[model samples]
Target chain A: MLELVTTDRGSDAGNSETAVTFERLLDLISRGDREAFSELYDRTAPRVLGLVKRVLVDHAQSEEVAQEVFLEIWRTASRFESQRGSAMSWILTMSHRRAVDRVRSSQSGHDRDERIGLRDIEPDYDEVSETVEIRIEHERVKRAMAQLTALQREAISLAYYGGYSHSEIAGILSIPVGTVKTRLRDGMIRLRDELGVTS
Target chain B: MNDRHDDDDPRLSTGAYSLDAVSPDEAEAFERATDASESLREETDGLVETAGLLGLAITPVTPSERMKAELMAKLATTAQLPRQEPVAAVPDASAEPESAAPAAPTPVETPAPDARTASTAPRAESRARSRWFARPATLVAGIAAAAALFVGGGVVGTAVSGGFGTSSVTDASAAGLAEITAAEDSQRSTVPVEGGGTATLVWSNTLGRSAIVVDGLTPLPDGKVYEAWYIDAEGAAPAGTFTASGEGTSWHVLAGAMNPGDAIGVTVEPAGGSTTPTTDPIIVGQTA
Candidate 1:
């Protein structure tokens, strides 16, 4: 059983569709697939680690959590159902849980305050240059996001990457909570329009 | 407003933002809206993907090459490895213990402790045959009086084959022979510094080397050692100590070899021989 999400025919004009194949590989891995799992690890580890690095902010802890999340994926892949979400969403969600857990485990707020005063540990982009799949995904999203102004991207990244709740984002931006809500919603609409998504 | 009256509600946008869907927030409003909107569940997913992309932007500290090896080793050790059968278990492969047998050279040292075989007959013969071993003269003197019956022979002190001078018992073949014959009990073959023999310990003045042939004596107690004393023929001062063994019929000169005028007498003492005799004389032999 597959849950298919319809992308705008016009918007996804150039994705090579490896995402579908990736999902298939994930399915095989769910069946105790060794080689498939290895392939999956090869393809996804960088991205998973990259994501975990953002929230956890510690390279060592991030990588460690990434491994744990992957192992968890291997163990619980059987429970994944197509109806709930895409394979990509499921894997990212798993990474989120592990990253958040790592964040909580580190008790790094004081230490974070002491270091550079940077709320979110900015990633080392020069480290893992974008892969083909990530590049494609990035291209699709950027095109959709192009509809929104640069201010919108900043707003979204701060909220998402910074883990700032809406109220906190409002306070950080020195704006009203209502204004933060408007900017976020409008930003999403512009993204949908730029991407030409049916929804 | 929909069932969710607030767009900037954290519940709505937080998950989506955490997911990295909107990619980034341009304004506080959009950021909060994304967090508030449950409809953008998948969009919030981008927060993490964005996290990944952002993570890539952070510097990487390269762990040493050995660190990776150490990691692999740890992985192998703690892999919760499935149990393989003993035959299949080769250690250094994942976590299985190495099943290979240890090397082969351990069984040969078990038999010969004294560097001599147990079956040797010299160590197994009658008490009188011990005289061939050579022993101390004092032991011979004691045995000359006491061991005449023990030898199963009609001859009494003649058992000592010492080349002694001007003694009533003047058998050249048997002067120290009583000492030699007396120590033969232990001299079963591997004679302990051969005791109860006829010949005295002949001393070398320069080297202090004394070699006495003794026979016919009892085996010395283990841990209880025998000390050889080099007494001047006048029988007063001690030269040094020789290790005495209560083993078989044999001549093992202790340290401080005898000079021409010195006599070799063995006294029982502690394990490593004492500086001087603390116990009574077990055997005293005059050497040739």
Candidate 2:
């Protein structure tokens, strides 16, 4: 029976165990274990869908892309190397790449221009309905993001959340592409320092 | 549009690459550079990890129940890529056998199928096999027949003993061999021995296991045995050792999970088997 818990209920503050569990599930899924796949889906579907929806901004299309991401995860679970990165990082990276590909391939130049125009007015991350642990993570990330310079924050946000290329970001911000690249690299270096992300 | 100057340093693009903001061509070039540099790869991996953290800021949205049902159904039919061990850099001078003159084949990338959920999506099954079978000089007869049996869908759930007599295989190994051969996704490859006879390598990606059956090879002397090896992009790993009967037939379940692009090789070794191959492979079965 499927446990239909939408939120990450009972998640503790420190998510150290979550990484191990995801890695183990991926190992089992590599062996064609269906139950492990189900549990993995149940645990991660909400975030996967949420991330896709954030980038694509179309509910139906987001669902479609999310489905593809999960299917890719199922097929390539064997390719997940824990030594390279966390399982969550691998899953989310693939999800982000798929969403970005869809956006780049399907959108017209005019649609992109319209999206660029609307980027400044977009809403910030929603916090009201999220669980306590998620809210805490949201707060940590929010605080880290606030440390970046305005241009750094805008460029990183547009590239990541908006799925825009560095050139597109340069066009949007009226800056040189080189400046955009430098800002992105410098900003991410800062974010890694701020987030204390160790490889 | 002289953006060439902007990307002069591939390291500059790591941030954008992690965000999936680079064009596919730029991404490919950046990946090539990253592959050659260890520090750059570490930096990129760190930034990618940091980028993944940004995903958690969004509000979680539970997918519709129908989507889960469809995904589960698709998973039931989908064949997974085989697990791959990390490729360790080995000194080519010492690793390569003098007699085996063919250069090590480059690893082929198996492209994931497009996002379309079509049930009949074409897979990279042949491409996977072509990774190890790149040199035609290494190939021999019986491949067409094996491929025909695979395409005709006549091999699934067939008795394992029927292909290679189980008399030489232990009861436990025979059972394991049967389980792998019975799997729906099992694949078979044949390699003719250098001296005489042939070896058939059967494996299932779904089961992550493999078994080799040898027939008509000259029986080894009392102090010598045939050692099986799982050769991947890194180097050769000792699988197990077995001896042929007077009739020169032997079967053994390979040790450890079979990685993608691994080729099963048989070499003559001392009775206990060496950590590394002491002689050139007599038969190398290129497995998908």
Candidate 3:
């Protein structure tokens, strides 16, 4: 349900080299190069910590977790495979997963319980970005999200932002698990298509 | 019967799976099917990458100065600096007899490889092992004791998967996992997540192996995965990534080594996992 955009905005045409740079740094880390690891951490820690903070919403714990995330990158730098994904995606994916794990482990009883009652209410997701590129990317995601059906958007956001599982989302929405799955898939596909994210 | 339209339902759940929203059981089934279909893998990868943009979409915030310093210090300790002297020069003090050993008490149970090799090690020491496995508390204690031996570096080698490769390493890891899960003195802790769920950390000292059973946990969005960690006062070591088990619970087998008094933690990390933990721990269960 997405309209094809011919615009050059948000395209990865120029950022391909950045991915290689990260891969190269990871490769050096694998060979026991501390300097490369430091460099990699400098370039990605903010991006990594940002996602963690957003998901966790606790500054103190976020810092603790961020420290753990970077330490992990140092220990497992050898495992990074450039072919599987871009360095940014690889690094950010790690950040998001770590954040979600924290959310699920500690917040399930309290934070999640509070969220269960308020599942219908949409979160105010404001990205305060000064960078032109990030601003555009945020706008693109916002526009794409707006086009999804309300149910689809809710299902996706609940899982995406709330970090709720399919069954959890179903329980919150009072819908069948199958329906939850469908809406999540449909919304994501639409979003992907809208964003022209063919990577 | 007419062709079933629902046959495609599983394929479509790629979005859910990519987002870490699929139940563990369904995710496994999807993983198997995806293994047989390259197109599905590619499609899911693209979707996951697109989801990565969602993280980038957030406003970037600077980490605390103390965090950077602490992280750099932690990394410095863990980094394998070049050895100025040969291993022979160290005299393998750890290899000496009890009298030759340092006066300080050994914090961990160091089982010498020559003394108790993995092969000669008893596979089934007692039927109590099975019974202990049935009960969470008993199982946890059993694993904790077992972990002391495992992390003490007496095992043949630490059982770790070499990245995401499909090799015999998987078989070794699977076998190692079974041993660790079955190890005596294994311990477990079920901690509450913020919203409303439980994450069970089960680990063994003998095999230095651990697994986490996540129940009623929320799934992550695309571009993110759940990363396990073994944390102590020094810092954290990355265990690995995992998904749900489809039984409303996901079981993750930890790969990194653990020390006594170390706690098992999980955080929402990037798909692979960050070198350090970036988010607050959703749950942390003490091992020692």
Candidate 4:
């Protein structure tokens, strides 16, 4: 039976728990184990869909992209190198890239200039569940985000979540394109450090 | 102006690129730099992984139920990925089979709905034969016959041969394609063209590479090639151009940066290609 999980019980168990388990699941999937692939999909699809939805914003397109991502995982299971990082990270990275691509290729690509023309508009914050673990993670990112200057946070969010390029973010923020790039770089570096991302 | 920035700190943008905060043009430049240096690619992968963690900050939302069902249906009919040695097997294997239940019924339910998924052979061999039979003389009738047979038998045969174990050139390319598809940064789109042909575009803006493959085209005239263009409202920008192999697969590598609003198009041109398309585009695919 497919266990439909509403939460990441893996997180509650600890980071290593989910990370190691997901790694093993990917390994089994590589060995042509369809069951293991299902488990991996169940465990990761929520965040994958969530991440894609955050970027693309359209429900149907997000689903389409998410489906393709999973299909890719099925085909490329052997390519997952455990030495690189956790399976969740790999899956999320794929979701983010695919979603960003969908956004960039869609009408948003051309319409972006108009959207970015709206200077000083607030970036949309994706709604989060009030669950303790999720809230804790969100609060951690928020705290790390607090360390950035307002301009830095704005620049990072607009680019990362809004799916706008640096030039587009620059237009939106009414800053030099160079300034937008610098702020985004610095903000990501700080955020990475805050999250203890050694890589 | 850009030259000085490159000199000051060429790698400074790696952070932003990892976050996908840069334009496609900037991304192409960043990848060209990274591709030349293995260490640079590793560093970029690390940064991308780091940035990917921010995804956890978003509240998880479950996808629709249809997704899982469709995925299972696709997997069941399609040939499974080639199996590797069970070297990576987990010792606590008992837990593995429990999750296999939902996917088990798929193979029984959907035997062969579509030829593409129904055929168990690696894409190259199957595609080659399919294209040959699909040539103009008997094109439509041949495709119909092939499709009917494609669904009738191969599924059971391939399942039995899942990994009897032999490596070949085709397997190697399939592996490479898998790696590309599995790449965290790659994007893909498949579009159907005129005369029952299909085109697939797989590109990685971060890698500074794009590939377009047109399959099942009726054999073009000798000394002719299909030219590719990146079209926007302004006009067409020449992408790399190429001729199809006898099997009717034409592959083009596009190194130029692509922006949003750019759609990929193909036109029949003389060998090599022209400064501008010489015919109406036979196929056009939107990029976004």
**Fnat for the candidates in order:** 0.02, 0.76, 0.50, 0.51
Error of 3 at B64 (Å): 0.7
Cα lDDT tens digits for candidate 1, A143-177: 55556677676666555455444565666778766
**Which ranges of candidate 3 are over 4 A from the true structure?**
A1-20, A112-127, B1-9, B23-29, B76-288
Winning candidate number (lDDT): 2
lDDT of 4 by residue, B123-240 (tens): 4322322333133345345435433332443322222112112235323333333333333454455555554555665545555445565543444554555677876556677886
For candidate 3, the iRMS in Å is 10.6
Candidate 3 CAPRI-style tier: incorrect
> Of the candidates shown, which would achieve the greatest DockQ relative to the real structure?
2
| Residue B286 local lDDT, model 1 | 41
Each candidate's DockQ score against the native complex?
A: 0.02, 0.34, 0.22, 0.21
* Residue B134 lDDT, candidate 3, scale 0-100: 39
Q: Give the TM-score of each candidate.
A: 0.39, 0.56, 0.51, 0.53
Best-fitting candidate, scored by TM-score: 2
lDDT of 4: 0.59
Task: Give the range of the ten consecutive residues with the poorest summed lDDT in model 1 chain B.
Answer: B98-107
> Which lDDT value does model 1 have at B202?
31
Poorly placed runs, candidate 4 (over 4 Å):
A1-9, A12-20, A108-130, B1-4, B7-9, B35-43, B76-288
Where is the poorest 10-residue window by lDDT in model 2 chain B?
B99-108
Question: Worst 10-residue stretch by lDDT in candidate 3 chain A?
Answer: A1-10
In candidate 4 chain B, where is summed lDDT lowest over 10 consecutive residues?
A: B99-108
lDDT by residue (B170-253, candidate 1, tens digit) is: 332222322222221211112223324332233334444544434334434344444566665244344433332223223444
